[model samples]
Target: MNLYKEPLSRFLISYNLCSQRSAKNFVKNNEVVVNGNSIKDAAFLVDTENDTVIVGGKILPQVKHKYIMLNKPEGVVCSTVSDSHKTVYDLLKGNFNETELYKLKCVGRLDNNTSGLLLLSTNGTFVNQLTSPENEVEKTYFVKLRDSITDKKSYVLKAEKGIEIPPENKSPAFISKSAFIKWLSDESLEITITEGKFHEIRRIFSALGNYVVKLKRLKMGDFILDETLNEGEFKFL
Candidate 1:
């Protein structure tokens, strides 16, 4: 069973009860109490449900759970708050009550210009589960390249460094393993990655001496972008 788990140091820091050093000091000074008993170890584990935490005489609010899936369209920002253009929340206008939106936040971020499946939730535990590197959620993408690809280059892309380009212009920023590329015509390709990084899909092709003409995320975790959910549409998971 997945019990409420968090490092004491992180718990204190997350609740703003104290800075890391201050938290350590609090432990050392016996100023923090867990389950009505003063504890001295900063790394101590506490049962989140059963333990009572008191720091500076204030109790931390218990976090609730939430989850959402958005078909983020190009030009929409995935941020919780934004200053320019429309945000992902803008698309959900009037769909959910204030309480729901208030608790809602993006699980993972997509660049403002990228389009694809975006996951959001207030469920910190589930969010952590999905985002953890150990989980290895596979994300797929449909990419368009500015130039045509040759069979030789395709082999190179699958084997050697492929079409090498500068770091900035590539699709995926880093390639842990040689990428799997399938040619769809000469300029379009489908790729898959178990690990997602900032602008990763775009950077990888750029590094291969090709610029990404269009990019769309096709899947995340086990979910795929349903053809029925048009751009700017979303569905409950």
Candidate 2:
């Protein structure tokens, strides 16, 4: 009975039915029907909870959102579909049917080699809120450097002061605020950052003239990775 208004293009994207560019085209071609009426405007609002949407003549069921936490292994990619490697979604095959699983999307992506806490959810708002840079959500990682620590005090100072992201890095230029770094040993440490820059942890060490031997996410905001779950294992939250 309640209305859940969402733009047609965004709904298509959230449903994984089409990419942003294609969604517009799909709508323009009248391939999408909402409540038995062919909708051509991509910006047209539809009720996600109550509207009956059909794409390519197939009904799109409206289902409740689900939240998931996963201990991602090193080899898995953060993608819905991948031709070369296993995706994070593939790990959920045992828990979800095709329709539900396809609706679930990664909250924030972890690179193919980076292992640790990965969040998956069907709630678009939840994913957007967590990943938005403006939210200043804290993400902590356990890092192992390739070399021994020469000066613990200096490393902490540089990281906390905000390391200058290199020009080559695709992430935004500004580091939001100070990061917290705790040295566990000469080669291992824990760093917490509020910004989700691409290869952020790795780049910080690289700017300090070091290499990251390993990196694993430990926490994101209030959601911490469940330590009990083994690599590649996931549980519904």
Candidate 3:
């Protein structure tokens, strides 16, 4: 029988038991068992088909990874679980009949106040590839403004020069990569960027003397928000 191995830590993360760091710590503490023997090494490998891994007295099996597209609604946090506010996981919990399918995680986050296309998955590698800052995966959003950007020409110029991020409490201010902005209306526009930063679109508009009243993501890489999905709804990719 030809067998393959995935590190114990990686498997635990991909299995959605915990984060990679937490999984490693769990192994180092001698909590994981393989073939009835305790293994304290995170690097211990598992044969996908044959080896039985037991965690908390439950036997686990290898499962095929799944990609899920969710139409995230505003106000829901993009975490697996949260103490307050609804989580994206809450939207999925009752929808899936399969326990394995219910273990999906957000690929990248949608801020609590921002809504629209969101991707979730049971596969950790896929999540890492898309979320890595090095990849520069394109993320596009539709923004509505409280203060209209009346100066279209000035807007283009400032955008081309790159929106300057103000220094946070005396830190040196820096310029961000030029963002692609297209006007959808006098007060609404579509913006695209490869980088994900905290409060990025709002900051960009604020720097330009405009206010972002609402924001919704429309696309990321090859995935688009399914118009048919009501807020907080999802479908498999």
- What does each candidate score in C-alpha RMSD? 5.5, 6.8, 7.3
State how far residue 175 of model 3 sits from its true place (Å). Answer: 1.8
**Model 3 lDDT per residue over 148-180, tens place:** 656877786787679888755444566878788
**Highest lDDT: which candidate?**
2
Model 1, span 17-62: residue lDDT tens = 6798788786787577777777788878765545678775666555
lDDT of each: 0.70, 0.84, 0.79
Q: Which candidate tops TM-score?
A: 2
In terms of TM-score, which candidate is stronger, 1 or 3?
3
Higher-lDDT candidate among 1 and 2? 2
Expressed as tens digits, the lDDT of each residue in 1-237 for candidate 2 is 112366778888877877988877878875788998989998888767688989888988875568899999998999888888999888889777899888888988999889999998776767877888888888999999999986899988878788776754556565536889999999999999987777777877888899998999999988999999999988888
Indicate the TM-score of model 3: 0.71
Q: Candidate 1: minimum summed lDDT over ten consecutive residues — where?
A: 158-167
Cα error, candidate 1, residue 126 (Å): 2.1
Ten residues in sequence with the least summed lDDT for candidate 2: 167-176
* Better lDDT candidate (2, 3): 2
Backbone clash total for model 1 is 15
